[model samples]
Target: MNPGASYQTELAQKLQCFFSDQQQGLDIPPAQLYRIEGFIEAGLLAGFITELGLKQTLVDSAKQYLNVEVADFYQQDYRLILHMRMHEAPVYPSSNPPCPQS
Candidate 1:
């Protein structure tokens, strides 16, 4: 499958997982579940980085550049950064266990 379809499938699966507690009486409709799942995934990813990462100044700077609220979507745009090796080197230093590819 193409990237778009794969993303959609992954998103759907995430929604189902996030809402597995159908019995919890959440103020969420199953139809709007994808939005919640996406939010959870983004929040969890950000929390992981903040809680376990290298705590580097550059990363904090990068997050600001991207706007903290949606920083989770800011993968190092190698094309935009130009400094290739410099960019990749941060990958190892940025997280304790390494950043996950979502």
Candidate 2:
């Protein structure tokens, strides 16, 4: 089989096994399961990386392009950098309070 097909099959099997194990004892609804699966798939595609690791890697590659040092760096390492930047950004509170619900 082609690499892409093989990867898809593997991913499917992993998702099946994961949901089956999760449902063994607990009562989880289908909608919840679907949502959880979406999160899992997203993480698999673009997941978190340790801040220390990312920093060290960047420091090591400061003089050169990261892609030159690591093949497919854009596919994974770049995402980590973006994730870190987004998460580390400062959040400011709104001046106005939220409207009270009836």
Candidate 3:
């Protein structure tokens, strides 16, 4: 697969596993649920979904499927940092010709 496709797949798998694990036995409040749902939706909009991955079908599917409500304690700043890391630009080696021999 292409590098972009591979990266997306890896991201989707990580997200799926993370959310699924979070859904184990947690009881989340409604307000926190809303925040969790928003975060998942943002991920979807940012192209984090796959054929069998997170989607916008219902109001609480993110909670039901990914269970991000567990992370509600994370502040906005922390979430932003995570988001930036996930979408960080790739670095490439400098292409300038090697300095001419003295």
Q: Pick the candidate with the highest lDDT.
A: 3
lDDT of each: 0.38, 0.43, 0.44
Clashes per candidate, residues 3 or more apart or on different chains: 0, 0, 0
Error of 2 at 47 (Å): 15
**TM-score of every model?**
0.24, 0.27, 0.32
Better of 1 and 2 by TM-score: 2
The digit string of per-residue lDDT tens for model 1 on 31-85 reads 5555654543454465432322322322343354334532332244322111111
Return the TM-score for candidate 3, rounded to 2 decimals. 0.32
> Predictions ranked by TM-score, top down?
3, 2, 1
The candidate that wins on TM-score is 3
Model 3 sits at a Cα RMSD from the real structure of 15.9
Which scores greater on TM-score, model 2 or model 3?
3
- Tell me the lDDT of candidate 2: 0.43
RMSD in angstroms, candidate 1? 19.4
lDDT tens digits, residues 2-79, model 2? Answer: 654564455445444433443343344566556544644454465332345434533344213223324234234534
Residue 22 local lDDT, model 3: 44
